[model samples]
Target chain A: MPLDTSTYALAHLRLDGRRWNELRRLHAQISTQAAADGSSYLEQGNTKVLCTVSGPQEQKGGRGGARDQGNEAKVDVEMNIAAFSGMDRKRRARSDKRVQEMQVTIASAFQSTLFTHLFPHSTITVTLHILSQDGSLLAACLNAATLALIDAGIPMSDYISSVTVASAPSSDQSLDEMDPLLDLNGLEEQELPFMTVGTCGRGPGGGEEKVMVLVMETKVQMARLEAMLSVGIDGCKQVRGILDGVVRSHGKRVLESKVS
Target chain B: MAPYTGIPLSPAELSYLHTSLSQHPPIRPDARSPTAFRPLIAETDILPAANGSARICFADGTEAIVGVKAEVEKTPSASSHSINSHSINGEVADEGVRGLGSGGVRDVEDDGMDVDGGEDGKQSSKGRDEWLEVAIDIPGMRDDDALPVFLSAMLTEALLADGALKDKLYINTRFHWRLYIDILLLSLPLSYPLPLLSLTTHLALLATRLPALVSEKDEDPLFNDDWEASTHLYPPTKDETARQKPPITLLVMSVGENILFDPSREELAVADAVVAISVTQSHTNTTGPDADADADADSPNPLHLIALRTIDPPSRLTAAGLPNSLNTSAGAGAGAASQSLSSVEVAVTREKDQGVSVWRPPRGGVKRAVLARMIKMVVQAGGVGEEVLGGLRGVEI
Candidate 1:
């Protein structure tokens, strides 16, 4: 499992046969669970997640009681990993520091992107259940939650889309030849040091995107981080387009049903 | 009643429940008998990454999943001596750098030594408690919250009560298996979830298996390539009939003269007392009933008590019945001053008709008689403990 560039170099294709800057096939559906206020199911390659949004309701007896005194709705995230979701059946404790950290990261990412002031003295809970994990787990959860929130009809400043990018390992030591890979799968993720980048608010005339969420768990060369980040942001923009299309089409169907 | 109960019930509602439960044959809300549990959907050996895993869902939509993971960890004692020597060597190196009198070398050496020393300090600091870890996660609770913290501590205490599990973890002189029991509660805001969590943990532990060690005991433990060769953590007896397994805790609630098992949220709202009893399959009671009589005996095994404790019902924390002294005019605007005045008058009229009311939290502490009944229900043969252990044993892998 060391990054052996020889095989990838033979064909400019990644382990999954995708080229540089290519993304895995992403499939998403909104309002999947009728019981939830807002719910969505998303699949990126082998990574799949189901997200539900419940709230903007009264903050019951919880830690949010103190912090919610401000004029903003607290965004709470609860992430659950199915034991059968990964290559191995691993059960992540709800109190796991790593899982809790991811939950905090997702919560804070939306806390800034959503229009929380509109619903003060309340809490917006986003619960994510990871059905399958290939790679880019955190990124997939973010995208799934965004869709579910939109379905919940929660107003947000912009769509927060996330993707993973990694600097390709090269035989030569030159940094210029190091091409960054976009939307890596589980295998590539394990072999390469990658970062998950979430972008919000499309740049005016598509100039630059705002980085709302940037998380890198593995160490990589500082010079290569910029390359990986830029690629991830571009991937997020591409993801946003796909998510936008889904919402618009679903809206069209709803409109047609109403008119009839 | 205490306010912690997520669901609020009116005084009339609480009274009706208490009166009904006080009857000779308690009429449960769900119509289940005093000893009957809510129907549950359960599955075992469902998680691939875990050595053993189980998921259980109650009729009320409460779901709990437990995973048992075991990793071969190097015993710190094996490396503690080496770390001491390495630290001594670092000190010698530090002195050599200072004696050189070169600021460049001293700065670089100082930073490296500090990092090494820090890591060394942390490594040797961990106690024997590092061998086993148990964590519980409920959706809305923090890791340090009283409920999750207490649940984790109780689970750990029950697992280590007999020290058999720890002994099973011993791999060799240099290494041992580190066991992680991770429990996750899917549906949250539950008032009493201890029984659900404990049941899931019991099923998961019963299904757990350890990779067969192909390497010699003195050498680095090597696992066999064939996963089928793996052995169950709680294997059956030599006869391959009855299995030895971890303990399971049951939540029992008392209402007036009746003791209810697996009580629901509404039932707990008016409960007089609640207790959790932990039990494990007995090893010494081999001569117990039907031990030799039945050939294909799938009969319930004898269980021994591990731990028992009373849990405060969440309903006691809720605000007592309405018509209190608190005023409703606090949030009324100036524009609605006259309107608010009229509303206050209406409230006063109703209060006069109903008379002044005062509510206090339910009394604490369990009666000694109720406590004895709770224990008997769990530990007595053919009781709740036996029924649960037998049910898990019948689960098809």
Candidate 2:
């Protein structure tokens, strides 16, 4: 119904009137839920997610599954999609295969990023609720979980900022003609190939990004994949800047209030 | 105080707590007065995705968040046919007769100020009970657990008690609004959490706004895109004094002769009885001939009681040791004298010196007079309800 990839040649504008390499609006707030050790609500355009982090506290019961190693703390990720999150009202089962796979991916990504050895025999649970979905659901959840863990005072190697990058369908089979879109929405996601990229690092444009998560579910030409990866990495850096700004401003406000 | 995780109080410490509580002016563990609530930090309109949202945190690390979202739904055609009536004058007459007897508070609950006119108002608002859907999420509890289920029911009842909220949801004869209230308890609660949850819900509801509708009459409703054009779901009164506010539930506990509001877990563990009292503002003073002239006076706003529910205090596991009052001995004379004679001697002497002894279980139920007194302390003029209402009035929404 709206503009699609074929229209990119007309004015070089993708859907929603954004050119390639332009990201959607990003907004985030931490410590929104005081009951949890750390919590955050993040919005990337129309996609919204709420995340809460609990523990590093001692694990209860004897069921130490594969996720919970004896020598290091365990990271558990749970995802819940509201029935009204999408345009249609469909209830997701608790054992949905796709959801379970995403949960594992998120858990493993954070397992390495956090210093789990510091809290042996404990568990850190990150629960995420998707309030709305447009596209880039995993990226929004990852970013929100990162902020919540930071608010929970967990030690992490670096901030893990994430975003999605899509490769625009080309008119011809030439490398020069292929364009990489920085962000994808629900409509574009259905018609284009996209990959979510996450990077952990300090400082802006530091030139070294330790990519922690890279997941691509759709098929794309080998020639187009490299450009999408690079664009995705660049988008991650920008997301890191925004996340850092939110943390700094929030910390300043907290400090000022405590001091006064 | 470490509560619910096996209270760590020994017999001596238990006795000391009992003695301190039985004093004429009970000294709470946190040094708050019997009526003073613990200080809390709260914020409203934080969640951008939801129509209205609020978060509240107590000093003891308990926190709760509430979000209210509204969606337009088509009214069920079956109910309209069943309750349809042509006697518009009859309903109007009944409403007027009731409005004159009570004040503004009842007026809101009874018929929602009767602003929508008599024709299809009752028809459109018929099946309003199912309009509000409440879903509560607490970290370690299932949705069907007693606490969550009870909480969901209580919150739904308090909001729908006066039917004012249902009146607001009426869009037209063919359509209405349904609210989805989602509450998340961030941390495990130590005391009864009804008050914390209810207060946060009230703030969230207060901040909720519905998009202004552009389409007129029974056609499909079209909302104005501009968010600034939206109107508040619970608008403040024209005079800025009183409004159609949601009822707020508060927890009150009695220990011995003392009545406490917002009791901490420690106080609740030893409470003789606990009750949740819900109240709303009654604009009784706003009426009468001298209403304008008396508006400037320093009279406190009156509150009307909506509901009073008794909650079981957390198990008295640690408080059932020895009696604090010297006159009452918990055990039989032989048992008190035989094996523990020396310890009993020491306890008796210590009780004489410090007016402290052993903790004894609350023998029976709370007196009718005490329950009445607790109600009076909460609902009376310049009472606990007024204080809470006054405090919330200053919060920016």
Q: State which candidate has the highest DockQ.
A: 2
Predicted complex 1: CAPRI docking category: incorrect
DockQ of 1: 0.10
Report the C-alpha lDDT of model 2 over B296-323, residue by residue, as the tens digit.
5444445666566787666355534434
Q: Which tens-of-lDDT digit does each residue in B109-158 have in candidate 1?
A: 11101122233233222223457778887776777899899998777766
* lDDT of each residue in A89-129, candidate 2, tens digit only: 44576578989988998999999999999998789999888
Candidate 2 — which residues are off by over 4 angstroms? A4-18, A25-50, A61-69, A80-98, A129-134, A150-156, A170-176, A185-191, A201-210, A241-260, B1-15, B78-127, B214-225, B283-301, B317-319, B322-356
Give the lDDT of residue A73 in candidate 1.
Answer: 93
True contacts kept of 1: 0.09
Residue A164's C-alpha lDDT in candidate 1?
93
Give each prediction's DockQ, rounded to 2 decimals: 0.10, 0.32
